[model samples]
Target: MSHAGDGAEVVLRLDRISKSFGALKANDAVSLTLRRGEVVALLGENGAGKTTLMNILFGHYLADDGGVEVFGQPLPPGNPRAALAAGVGMVHQHFTLAGNLTVLENIRLGTEGLWSRGAADARAKVERLSRDFGLAVHPDAKVGRLTVGERQRVEILKALYRDARILILDEPTAVLTPQESEALFATLRKATALGLSMIFISHKLHEVMAIADRCVVLRHGRVVGEVDTHATDKGALAALMVGGELSLPRAEVRVPGAVLMRLDGVSTPNRGAGPGLKAVTLELKAGQITGLAGVSGNGQAALAEIVGGLALPVSGSIMLKGEVVTGWSPGAALAKGVARIPEDRHHQGSIADFDLTENAVLEGYRSRFSRRGWMNWRAARAFAEGIIKDYDVRCPGPETRIRLLSGGNMQKLILGRVLSAGPEVILANQPVRGLDVGAIAYVQSQLIAARDRGAAVLLISEDLDEIMGLSDVIHVMSQGRLSPAFARGTMTAAELGLWMAGQKFEAPDAA
Candidate 1:
C-alpha cells in the first residue's frame, strides 16, 4: 500500500479534498502530494484554511468530501488514532505543554498516562536526541523555566518519540531565535535525510524558501499554486499567498535625535543554564526603530524585561531620556516615557476577561480614564470607541470582551493603548505575532507613523520581514551575544538569516 508511484517516490497524497462549514467553503477542492524525504511549505494568511486542512489530516475535523491517502492507503474520516498509527505527527503553533511540569513529565504526560515505566529510558533518549539534533534542551528543566525555543524543541521531541515518519510543524520558527531556528532546520534536514517527510506551515516567505524543497500556497481557502522553492523568489510566493502584490514598504529615513534609552554593561542571571546575555550594551534613539533581531532564546526576553521594567539588570545602567533609570519600577519606566508591549499578549499585554474599554486603558487607567480615585465609565467608553475607530480595530463594541476578538484585533487594541499615550519610547516585542496580511500592514503603518512623530521604537520580532521592513538599524543576537552587523536599505533575507544563525560579521561601523 506504499504510495511509491514508480518505486519510492510519493509518500502521501490528498486528492480533490473539500471541506465546508455551513455556507462557507473552508477547503475548495484542494490536492497535494508529499514525496519521500521532502519538506513542503504550506503558505497562507490567517483564516485561509491552512489550519483547517491540517486539522482534517490530524482528524480534528472531517472533510465533507474527498479522501486522504497515506502510503497510497485511504484514511477514514475523523480518526486521529489512525493517522498517528500511520506515522503522522504534528506540532501545533501553541504549545500543548503543562507549564508546571518538567520537560520529561510533559513529554510523557499523555502518552504514558497513569503509568511511568520508561521515565529513565525516555529521558536518556531525549537527551541523546537533543544532542544529535542540536536541539540542546534539558530534559529535567521545568517547562515554565524553558524559553519559547526550548519548549518548541520539547514538542518536536514528543512528536519524534511517537515514531512518526511524517511531521507537521505549524509556524515552527514563529517563536525561535535565528540560531535556534537554524538548529531546528538542521534537525529537519537530518530527519529528511533519514527518509522522514515534513509539512512546514508558516507566514514567513523567506523561511519557506530556505528550508522547503517545494512550496504550496494557500489563499481564501484554496490551493493557488505549488512550485519548487529553487525556481521562485519571495515576491512570487507572496503574490500567491496574498492573491495580489504584497510589497512591504520601508520606513522613511529620519534623523534620530536624543538618546531615548541606553543600556551599558547590561547583564542578567542566566534565566536557564543554556544561554543568557553577557555584557549587553545597546541604545535606542528618538524617532527611529532599533530592531533587536536574534534567534529566539539569546536574551531577547531578558533584554525586554530589563528595558520594560519587568526584570532589573544585574550590572548595568539604563538611561531614559538622558536620565539613568536602572532598577526603576514599571510605573517609573512609564513616567520616564517608556511603554512596553509585552511579547505574550494573552499573559502580559491584556486582561482576557476585561472588556475592550477596560483593556484599552489598562496601562493608563489611573489618570486618563479614572477620576476621583473611582472608575470613570464615560471616559473609558469614549476612549475605547476612539481607539476602535482610529486604529480600525474590529470588535462588537466597547463592552466586548478582549478575548472575543481575533488575534489581530487584540493586537490592534493593545497597540492602541500604548500609542495613544504618545510615549516617547515603545518596546514592542513580537508585536504582530498572529496577524493577517492586512492587519500586519496596518500595525506596521502605525509603528512607522509613530516613528515619524518622534517616538523611539524598540522592535523585537521573530518575523524577519517585519524587522527588515521597519528597522532603521537591525541588531542581530546569537547565543546571547549581539552581532555587530547592522543592515540598512535593501539587504537579502538570506544574509540576515545567516547573521541571525550566529555567523560572525563585520562591525556595523565597517559596513
Candidate 2:
C-alpha cells in the first residue's frame, strides 16, 4: 500500500506543541505530522513526551504554546469532542471501556443519542469492521468477559465505528501475546489500506520496525531525530530514542538451588467468569528464574497472587522453604522473604496519591518503618530518598507523588523498595511491561542480579520472547492448568504455543 511520501496529503499536524506540569516540560516545542495511509512511530523513553504530544493532538491536554490541525482544519484546544468530531481517535495503553457494558454498547457510546434508532445499523457496521480488519469479537459479548486481546480489538472497533481517519495507539501490544500482537499488526495494515493514518507509540523497537513506515524519536520532550523505517535498523532507532547504545541484559547460566516456594495441586475459584488456578503444581528454586508463559487471563494472575500472598488456594498446599505455610498474607510473604513486583504498577504496585516516601514504605512500614505504636518519619524519608537515588528514579523529590513520575521511574522505586529488603523469593509479574528499552534493560539486569544473589524468581509474562530469553525452566498455563516444566531451549515457541492453546493438555480428572 502507498504510504506517506512527499506528495501525500497531510491528515494531521502538531506545530511547536508545548505542555508542562508545574516545572516539568513534558512536550517542549514539539512538531509532528501524519500523512494519509502512513504509520508514524513515536519512539521515546517513558516520560519523553510521546504521550503528552498525542494527548495534545487528541485534546486531552491543551498545548501551552502551539496548536493542532486535523485535515487542514484547526482543532479546538482542550476539547475531546472537537477532536473526535474532526475524525481523531485515540486508543490509550489502558483501555477506556466500561466493564459492565457490551462490545456494541461501548462502540456506540457517546456517538449516538440515547434511544437512537441506529442499533441495528451500528451492529452491522461493527460486524463488517470486525470481519474486514480481522478484529474478531462478538458484538454482544460483555466487555468484562473478554480477553485482553479481545478488549483491545473492541477499542480499535470503537475508533473505527466513529469514522476515525487518524488514529493514535499507545503501547497497543503491551499486554498482547506474540500471536495476538501479530493479529493486531495485520489489522493495522488493513486499516492503512483503507487510507487511515496512525501514530504508533511503543517501546518495543521490533514492533516499530515491523509496522511503522517512519520513526520519529523524542528525547527530553523535544524532537531529536526522524528516520525512514526502510533505511534504518532497530539498533539505530534504539540509539536515537535513548541517545546512546542500548544493550539488553541476558540471563546467565547458573545452577538452581533448593526450592524456595512450591505450590502442589493448588486450586483457586474462578474470578468472575475467568478461570482460576486448577491443580497447578509449580516450583521456584533459588538462583533461577522460572518463567510462566500464557495468554492474558489464563491463571497467570492467580498464580502470581497466590505466590505474592494476595490470595490463597482453595485446595492443596503452599510450601515455602519446604515448610507448609499457614495464614499467608502480603505481610506474611514479606516476613518470609518474598518480594513481589505486581503486574499493575499504577494500582497494585504503588498508590497514586501517596508521596514517594509513603509508597516506599507501604509493604514494610508496619514492621520496618514503625516502632511500637509510632511511625518513623525520618527513617521512612531516608529510605525513600535512598530508593530514589540508588534506583535512579527521576523525580522532584521524595515529597513528590508517585502518580507524577513516569512508568519507568515508578517501577524503579518499586524495585528498590522490594530489593532492598533482600528477599530470597521474588515474584516479578510483567516486570517490564510498557517500559522503554533503556528501562527494560535496567529492570531485567536487576532481576538477573537478584537471581545471581540466590533469589528464586518467578517471572510471569505474556511475551514469549521474554519467557524464552530469561527463563531457566518454562511452564505454559492454559485453562488454569500448568504444563510440565521444560528446560530452557528444550521447547520451541510453536510447541509452547500449542500448550498455551490447550492442545497439549490432558483431560481434567473427574471431579
Candidate 3:
C-alpha cells in the first residue's frame, strides 16, 4: 500500500490535510509523502506550517479535515501511541528527556517492564546505534550533564529505542556545531543505508541539499513544490521557500565608537559539564555587532546571562556605558538600557499563558507601559498594538495568549519588544532560532538596523552562515575562552571551525 510515486517507494503519506485554529489556517490541503530509504527535507518559512504538519503527522495535533496513511493503511487522528506503534518517531526542537536521569534510563522509559534492568539492554542498543550512526553520546552519563549536541543524540536514541522506521526531526541543526551537524548527517546517511526513512525539517537549504534525497517545500500552509535534491540547488529551493532571491546585504562597518560595554577578567563557573570560562576579557563597542560564535553549551549561554545581568559573574567587572553593573539584576540592567532577547523564548522571553500586551511589557513595564508602579492597561495595549503592526507579528491583537502564536511569530514579538525599547546595548542569543527564511532575513535586517542606530549588539548564535553574513567582527568561543577577534574579511568558515575546536590559529589583523 505505497503512495503512487515515480521512483522511490512511499512509506507514509498525508492526503489533502487541513487544520485551522479559529481564523488562522495552519495547514491547507497539504499533501506529502515519505519514501523508504530516502531523506525527505521538509522546507518552509517560519509560519508556513511545516512544524504543524509534522505535529499532525506525529499525532501531536488532529487535523480538522483530511486523513493520513502509513504504508497505505489509514491512521487514527491524534493517536501518538498508534503512530509510534506504526513505526513513527519524532525528535522535537526542545528535548523531552528527564535531565537528571541517566541516558539509559531516559531511553528505557515507557517500556512495559518491571524486573528487566532494561538499562543494560538499552545501553547495549545505544552503543550499537551510536557506532552505526556516528552519534557520540555517553549512554551512562546523566542527561543533565550532556552537551546540547549530546542531548540531541539522546533524543534520536530515544526515538530509535521505539524502533521507529520513519523518524521526524524538527530543526535538528539549530543547536549543533558545524562538526556536530556534519556528524549527524553522516548518521542519517547510515540510517538510510539500513532502510530507515526520515523526514528532516530545516530552514537551511544547504543542509537539505547535502543530506536529503528529495525535497518537499511548503508555503502559506500548502505544498508549493517538490524537487529532487540532486537536481536542484540552494538558490532554487530558497526561491521556492521564500518566493524571491534571498538578499543578505552585509552591514556597512561604522568605525566602532567608545567602548559601550566591557567585560574584564570574567571567570564564571561552568554551567555545563565542560570547562569553565577563564579570565576572559572582551569589549563591545558602540554601533557594532559582536558575534559570539560557537557550538551550543560552550559557555555562550553563561556569557549571555552574565552580560544581560541575569547571572552575576563569579569574577569580573561588567561596565555598561562606563558604569559598573557586575552584579546588577535583569531589572536593573533593563533600567540602565540593556535589552536582551533570551535564547530560550519559552523559558526567558515570554510567559506562554500571558497575553501579547502583558508579554510585550515584560521587560520595561515600569517605564514604558506603566507609571507609579501601577498597571496601565490602555498604555500597554496601545504599545503592544504598535509593536505587533511594526514588527509584523501575526496575532489576535494584544489580547491573544502568546502561546497560541507560532514559534516564528513568538520570536518576532520578542524582537519587536526589544527593539521598541530603544536600548543602548542588546544581547541576542539565538534570536532567530526557529524562524523561517523570511523571518531570518527580517531578524538579521533588524539587527543591522539596531547597529546602525548606534546600539551595540551582542549576537550569540551557533549558525556560522548568519555570523559570517551579519557580523562586523567575529569572536569564536571554545571551552569558555574566546579567540582573538576576527575582522569580518579575515576569517573563513574553516578557520572559525578550527578555532571552535580549540585549534590555536591567529586571526589576520587587517580586514
Candidate 4:
C-alpha cells in the first residue's frame, strides 16, 4: 500500500495529464498514483493545479493529453457518473445537500434507483453505515436542522453508501472543531483499515502530517515533489509548495488607546431557532486586535453581525466612542467609522454578479463616488483600479466580473475596499479562511497594519492559529455566550479548545 508495492493494487493512475484554460495551463503533464489502502495528501498553493488534477481524475474535466486509469482500466473523460461507477467519489468543500430534504432523501436522490430499495431498506442501510463508521446523523432529520459538523458526516455517508472504494475529500475539516476533526480522522483511519484509498486536500500542515501517509506537492501546474509525511516537516512542505522562503508577519508593539467600543450585557433572543448572544460584555480598544476564536457554527456570525450593526440585540447597549450606538443601521455604523468584513464572502462580502468597479463602490457610492444623485462611473472605476493595483488582484481587467476572480483575489479586493475607507473600528470575520499561504500572509499583514494605525479590530475566526498569532486579547465564543477575555500569551490552545467546547474558565487575577 505504501509507495505502491510490486504486488499492491493501484486504484488510480494518471500519466502525463495536461489541461489548459485559454492561455493558462491549469495542469501540465502531471502524474500521480493512488494505491489500495493508502492515504495521499495533496499539497499546493492557490491556483497550483491540485483541484484541476483531482477534477481530471474524477471525470469533471477532460484532459487535453494523457489518461486516467481506475482499477487498471481507462476512465472516460468528463463523466462524473462513470467515475462514481468506477469507485471514485469526490466530496467538495461546500456540501451539495438540499436543506428541506431529509438525510435519507438526499442520499437516495442520485445514488440508488427506485427499484433497488424502498424507504425502509434505505434507512436500514443508513443506520448500518452510520454505526459502521463513526459518522452519526439521524437519517430522517431535515438537512437544514443539522449542524455543520453533522452535515459533513452526511456527505461522507453519501459517498460511502454509493459503494466508493476511492474517495477524494477537498478541505474536509475546513469548518470543523478540533474535537470533530479528531473524530473524523479516527473514522477515516478505520475506513483505510478496511481497504479504502483516499486523497486528502488541505492547507493545514499539521493535520496532513497526522492523517496522511505521504504528501504530493504541486506548484504552478506541475508536480514538484513527494515525500513521506513522517519524514518531512511542515516547513519543508510549505517551501516546496510555495516555491520560496516564507515570511510571516511580525507582531508590533503599540500602546492601546481608550476604549473605542463597549458591549454591556448584550442579549439577543433567537426565538428557538438557534444560538444568540446572551448577556455578553466586552470592550475593544484602539490599536489592538481582539480575536474571537470558535468553531464554525458557534455564535461568531451573530456577534460579528451585531457589532457591524446588521443585527441588533434585544437587550443591553453598544457604546462606541462614548456614545450609545445600539440598534443602529449598517449605514449608520459605517458613517460612525465602523468597517465590516463578513464571514461568508460570496453572500455577505460582495455581490457576485457585479463587476469589480461596482463592488468597490458599495459603501462609498453615496459619499465618495456619487455627485448630484448620479453615480460617477469614472470615479468608481478609478477607485477600483487603485485597489486592483495596490492589492495585486489577478484578473483580466478592472471591469471584469467579480465572480470570475479566484477566491483569494476577491478577498484582496474586499480588504482593499474596506481599508480604503480608513475606518477607526473593524470587524473582520473569517478574513483568510480559504486563501493560500501567500495570500494569508498578505491579509494578516494588512490587518496588523491597520492595528498599528490605531484602529480597534474585532477578528472573528475559526482558526486558532490565526487568533493566537494576531490577537492582543483573545476570547472564545460558544453557544451564544462569550468567554472571559484573556490577554495574549496568557492562555494555551488546549485551554482555549476546552473553552470553545463550552467549558467555563475563570479569568486570570490581575495584581
Best by lDDT: 2
Could you tell me every candidate's TM-score relative to the true structure? 0.78, 0.92, 0.87, 0.90
Pick the winner on TM-score between candidates 1 and 2.
2
Expressed as tens digits, the lDDT of each residue in 362-457 for candidate 1 is: 888886766789998898899999999998888779999998777888898888889988999999998888776667877888889989999899
Clash totals for all candidate models? 5, 0, 1, 0
Which stretches in model 3 have alpha-carbon errors above 4 Å?
Answer: 1-5, 98-103, 112-114, 117-128, 136-145, 270-276, 322-327, 368-380, 502-511
Question: Which residue pairs come into collision in candidate 1?
Answer: 3-71, 176-296, 177-295, 177-296, 178-295
For model 4, residues 3-80, the per-residue Cα lDDT tens digits are 434366888899999999998899989998888888999999889999889888878789999999999999989998
Please list all clashing residue pairs in model 4, or write none if there are none.
none
Q: Please list the C-alpha lDDT of all candidates, in the order they appear.
A: 0.82, 0.90, 0.84, 0.87
Give me the overall lDDT of model 2: 0.90
The superposed Cα distance between candidate 1 and the true structure at residue 218, in angstroms, equals 3.3
Model 2, 1-511: lDDT tens digits are 2356768899999889989989889999998889999999999988798878877877778788998999999999999899999999889888999999899999988888636977888889999999988899999999998878899999999998999999899889877766678889999999998799999988778888899999899999999999989999999989988899998888978899999999999999998777999889999999999999988788898998899898999999999989999999988999999999999999999999999999999999999988897999999999999999999998989999999888999999999999999999999999998888899889999999999999999999887878898999999998898988899999997788778777778646311
TM-score of 1: 0.78
lDDT of 4 at 4: 36
